[model samples]
Target: MNNSLDQESSRVNFYIRNWLLGILFIISVVGLVALIAPPNTNDSMGYHMPRVMHWIQNQSVRHFPTNYTAQLFLSPWSTFTILHFQILSGSDRFANLVQWFAMIGSIIGVSLIAKQLGANRYGQAFTSVFCATIPMGILQGSSTQNDYTVAFWLVCLVYYILLSLQDETGKHYVLPIGVSLALATFAKPTAYLYSFPFLLWLFIVKVKLLRWQIYQPALQLAMLVFAVNGFHWVRNFQVFRNPLGTSPDYIIYTNRAFSIPIVISNIIKNLALDISTPVPSVNRLLLNVISGIHELIGADINDPRTSSSNFQLNSLINQEDLAGNAIHLLLIFTAIAILGLSWKKKNFNYSLLNYILCIIAGFIVFCMLLAWTPFHTRLHLSLFVLSSAFVGAVLSKQWSLKVVNLVATILLISSLFWLFFNETRPLVANSNLLKTGRVENLFIKSRTYWYFVGRPYFRESMIGATKFIKSQQCTDIGISFNKLDIYEYPLWVLLNADTDKKYRIQHVAVKNVSEVKQNLEPFKRFNPCIIFDSSGIIFEKIPEQKGNYEQKWFLSPVSVLVKTKN
Candidate 1:
């Protein structure tokens, strides 16, 4: 009993000595508050939540016709969590908690990997905090994005791989590695790019260590991965004649194949966008360089034709808050500097260093080759989270525990402040200050409490339009839009809220006015009581419908054309 008391006293002293613990606690509390809030991000409203709702309504995971190819083809692992949570909670209020838990799992996974890599407790704590402090991770963690979920699974895969390597018995660890890989892949197709090399490394290690017996576990791992993820592929193959669905064609048609120099230039531009502050001279230099590279590649940076992709890039760079990429850049540069200084030192672990280098190189090459988004930084979440282990390892070797604690404390506090003031302040600034109150009232008072409830797109027009549709008591609705998937969720949620019999919502793809006119013929037979036109498709009443329809326009540029003589 006396020894136990001494141990407890020591633990308390350790935390007091390391103020970073207190800082991490504070940041975690803020993240939890944000997670409990409702999800309202455009992507979440557009398809993520909608897809989950569809699965719940159907009571099974099967193909449904959707104008948005992603709703039909994207892997359902992440949405599965949302569906389960919504079912358990009996509401969508807990949707963001899935990603929040994923974030926490990622932090724990990083720490476990650091430990496996021979980091001390201080080093492990530092690495975990480092990952948590990334701006993209925090924002996505508090929202409903699959990137963090995939990152969590990838980190778990690494931790299990390391565990399997160290386990001489090796019976229990192989299955976990397989399960983690499957979960990661099913969560996001990009997981294949991020994880294939690591899986290959694991195979080589198993063969070197276990020889012929390795085949049994290896086969088991393969079977597990295939078993968990095969349904999605098989479904796609049956429907689309390709297991990957239309993504390959979409990629080929939508993105230009750039030369190596152009790709490199774009990467640097993305990096600058991610990390660089809003200094005028720095912005000017970055713009000039980006423009010069575009010119060299025979692409016009300002061409309206290419502006959609460019706008995505600009929005990610400009709209995201002040944390940007500074923390990531600093961690990377510091790791490199520490690696160089320690090269001649006797304690360097060459095997671990080689593995880390492989991961970094593989991720960079993958991004250069296939990642075309302006929001490419988000795609690198797994890469950065895994790399935090190396940064912690290096910092542990070079710096004292006290110094490491100080640095981590400073970073955590700064990141927490930026998250509160810059990223989420708009959501909570005019609220009742997060006081003790009922969850429902807190949600009601906080404008930014829910992304869909608080955001301009949903609040300004989508809600009103949904209400108007409900008031009209329309049973059949036809939705035609350029990108219907992103705007389909709100309508789905509002229309189906209290119904035992589902409302029939049909989607028609409309790229231009001619397509809309041509498509109206088929929809006429369905005789949808109303048509929601979002693509500016209904410039005038359809020739077939002459004087039967009247249009009601919303601020979203969405029109609810009710059939007056149906």
Candidate 2:
């Protein structure tokens, strides 16, 4: 019996050692990709890093005139961290690390949550491996996107809530809960939806233990929240007359109405995102079933009122912005079914069961309140992260070692494609790296590389445009872009705006909801000798003169550099 017990211990240690090595390899690859790739993501180029640049230029986080109102209005906790890193490093070299660190933190946080849920050492190892292999998490982990960051904070919040419940001493976790909640709230709007039910659960648990000591902790919680978000809230109120900064974009992503049919429609459409397969026929069949369900419920699947845009079920994608976690979702459903079948058992842990139910409630709240967009899969990161604890707890009990190892192996295998073949930042290309430059200068130095990979011409066009601007000896340049979705960061990098203090790049002739709000700032006298336009149409007016722009150089039809003439 003693020999058998020792052998069992040795086997568990060996399995855990192998699992840890696998997780290490997975994160190392993801981190290597992140270190090699620049911030070339759509949202990062369009608004995320652009806003950081604007704040750096203005030396404040105040609202500025811009075509993309999202830069001004989106909750900015993640970018706030990015801005500090950029300033510290004196470059955007560390931009993607913000999400990479979040990815790491999320893995550690989930493992802790699993332990709290009664998972053994092997179970905790499995939890870390599972989280590290989530396709969407792996893809976003290497980008400057905030889905992973927000998911990290939410995981911290859930873990602390679990700790507070299990702690006999009350109010010990109040500060962590407060800090995590504030950060998550300011990270993204989706954090609110994903965090609602768990927060409610915390509140209910805390209220049952109400006492005189709770008041101080409660006050500490409020003050901590305000300390984190108060300045941004004041700025929003000053600009938008609403502390929330509910821009038109926000309304489009929000559900316009609350009805049973709308809720059911949203739930189905949102779930279908994860259920999607790479096969076109499978996608069509799934889409048809969703449409049929919507029709039966007397709701339109593509209702503009509740849809961000035209809705289509996406196929398997390696892109961070739209990748589906089909394998993980399947595992979650399997774990749920397993839990349900054994829920009546005498030895089951009800605490872990209740926690899983709260996360499900959060998902239900999300579907009921938010519109169905193809990118909702990325927003579902928090839900997926929280479910790892459940999966860990279920697999830790009764399941044989072979079954658990098999699931972990499957996840790691499925994750390889995403690791190597990311849509924008592929690691196995002909050149093997996205940027074209020296080995040390791949991410550190600028080249005529693809800032937007899909638009290959953007590289040469932006380089040529910047050279033209330099030749004209213009320090004060004006940017007038027609669309909000255009890439603006390449312009900054190409011009060496970070190192050269003489360059003053400002948005001129801005006409948007933010135009009137930009008035709050004392206007600077900006008269550009040259204006850059992405639309190929120059501005008709400058500061004082009825300035007409003559096309000086054209690198591409879309990238036009024009000189202002009175």
Candidate 3:
């Protein structure tokens, strides 16, 4: 009878462990699904992943074109964040898979952060659930957007930071912390500023500056991180002859305020429009209401209404996203309440809150500097992870720890609901979010070409474009797309997917369509057999009639030109 009881006891423990693992497994799946689903999140499809593809093809991690992916160059840290994507999976489909797993890494990292903060298993699990379920986190993670990865690295950084703080006399923690921050920066240029917090914490809580010796190791770690990440810079400088990978045209051209009033207003506006906490941007509210009215009066849900800029927008949900936001707000505020109540007494972990605040401040300020546009939650996803995890830790009060776990369970269930229903996607079979401007339209269509071929979100769509290049047997291919910003990543994917085959595909990079004449004069000199072209956006120096070329490749809004003379 004792033996039988032992077997039953062992079974119970095994069942419970598997059950918890099962729950986390489901949350991870939610993270992956969010990435592969709609909106392409960010103009990301046209950005970095394409660079990853290019690096793979070139057999070196460098900028293929400085002008082509200047923003990525500007945000130097992002290069290392997705470098693995170039190595393992150059296809849009594979990138999607990589993103999914990266998200899982993020979730795992989040769990570790909670654990290091002295939270128990229940606390760690709840925080991970919160990160996975919050509408904005889910929304951002669901796409191939960079913010999700940023959050992942940030969580890892914070966890290691906490671990470092707890370490009494070792400098080893410093290296890991610096490396994580360096990587976090690549995921978002804004992360370059996050270093302020870690340094502050190291000086204030850990090293205390009483000993000047730690500074040397710390400085060395920082330098190593920069040295490792500097290859992308070298590549960009070599190509663009400039160190920065990004452009400031959006802010420069907008004529929007960059002055004191504007900067302060931007910071206030960014915090005010917090999605996890229940506030919406003017665009989002107007969008939701308009989408609701359309749904009530016969418009399709998936292809909802576009921006009031006057096209239809894709409905990102079956409902207003307000309920999801409300629950998160309560959790956040309650967490804040707990933190405030326990600020002096909560001795669970190190008192590095001040330094974290410093980092958060730096990150927020940096984002504000770039704030000609409204702040979207996706851009702020990493902050949300930090804030939410702290709150989750607070709410996992000793007496109510079970309640915290229960609420997290419910959120996990909700995430599963969205995953299956994904009310955000079109009710019809295939759908996409359309961007503004003619060039953006062509970029969207070229992406749509990939979407129709089964790559789900914008990032995956890039991998789809790469697959397109791989299928083409010709090596000497030349392409002229209207806008570099929108197609930079796609170009990277196409060029990198197969570099060994020797397809001399030249992306005719010129400032304007007027420069297309100058850009193509060389191609004409070389006499390329086929030149791929895209046209929902116009990039023409001479009339189509004046160009002595035959159209050979058809991408619909895109085409290929066979040059008769070089």
Candidate 4:
């Protein structure tokens, strides 16, 4: 009796010390990395940040009609629905700082998820730190974007639902999971992508747990998850006529074509395309066959762009951000090693939930986000985290063999050290604040996801010009570009928004030279009191005039014109 009591006490002490040290490390890294600003992602800068700013100013949720694809995140879309947290107080400094806490919080979430999923001490430690090391997670977490935010909640909700499923008595069951599901789905509509895997995992778990008759418990968990996540749906319906107003329709445009086989094949192919340099054997014949069945799921079923030939072959080998990639590669290896080493659990009951969790979670995520999933390491960060814990479990199980354990441990340590020691400089450098020239720099210098050639850019110059127009003490302000926040900042950030007229804005979509002319002629009619025109646009207003209007040119092809209606 004394021996048994001592064993229990020892276990308690071990957890206490482990938790304290692990938390300290998590806090330190998240704080240190938080110093940087969001890296350059045109879409993020153009829409997400601005959208949050608008929500802050308006204090209400509304659709963006002015934006061409304004309906995209129709219901509540902006950087995967971080609008909730971003809407908290609307302080730039605070939001930026939130980036730090969120990163650490994600590590905490990952650790908790691992433990709840039956991960042991080593499993928890490996999963938590490995999450920090992945280059994509580190890079995105360092930025102000919402992918990592979405990732954190996604993992947390899944873990919590499983916890609810743990009860044989159907306790606080569905309420917790329901609320969590609501939060997750609201965070990113992509959360719906998990439906298949989530439901699949539930069924699998139910089958396994039926010996204890946990059916009521499962039902309750499901109900609660639905309830918590239902608001997003309600609001989405109000705005877009759909519960989840923001997603593929506005972005992917599957109406033109849908291919199940291509989606399935590319689901696997894209994984390789995202991680490796060499194009794994082109399943050209398969793609051709899948093309016929696009509606069902095809092979060449490229979703981002309409054509399969659009793949940027040159970029596959040109991953320039050495530090980021080094971190990416090292983290991937460590996760694999950890999984390899932790693969064993003497008791199957303790391991069942996590096993089903990994399989279901991994499948849903890969499938739903498949076509839109980035082809770079940073884009694949969430997968790395999910895969790592499973990897850790596998590693632990396999490590029972003496030689295998040593080898796995050494590889894991080496990859981790390489990530932390060698590549720390790039990701955490100067907050990567999405400055003017940094977009191109990130492309040429850093092997980050931003290097992709087609991404958009927004500059402080645009904001500066907007301020100049607003300060003229004019009646109404008009702009020719789509980015409202680009010009709305200095005034909104510096001036009083209660002035009734924050500023009226307009923009034209320029597809070609002809569209450019058609876009400017209307601006001439509105005669934006002070025309903000760029040199690139066709305008009669003096490009260098000191007269009634200001012609502002930003990015390369796009410019804003402000002129009076008089």
Number of the top lDDT candidate: 2
Q: Would you list the C-alpha lDDT of every candidate in the order shown?
A: 0.66, 0.79, 0.51, 0.46
Of the pair 2 and 3, which is ahead by TM-score?
Answer: 2
Better of 1 and 4 by TM-score: 1
Question: Can you list the residue pairs that collide in candidate 2?
Answer: none
The lDDT of model 4 is 0.46
Q: What is the TM-score of each candidate against the true structure?
A: 0.82, 0.92, 0.70, 0.65
Please, what are the lDDT tens digits per residue for candidate 4 over residues 306-418?
Answer: 33234332222222231134333454455455544445745444454455455545554555343433333444455555555554444444444333234433443533332
Q: What tens-digit string does per-residue lDDT give for candidate 2 at 325-391?
A: 8888888888888888997998978887788899889888998878778888888888898898889
lDDT: worst 10-residue window of model 3: 303-312
**Root-mean-square deviation per candidate:** 5.9, 3.5, 9.0, 8.7
- Model 3 vs. true fold: TM: 0.70
What global local distance difference test value does model 1 have?
A: 0.66
Off by over 4 Å in 4: 1-30, 36-40, 68-90, 97-99, 169-172, 203-235, 246-261, 277-309, 313-365, 368-379, 400-464, 467-471, 482-560
TM-score of 4: 0.65
Rank all candidate structures by their lDDT, best first, as comma-separated numbers. 2, 1, 3, 4
Top-down TM-score ranking: 2, 1, 3, 4
Model 2 TM-score?
0.92
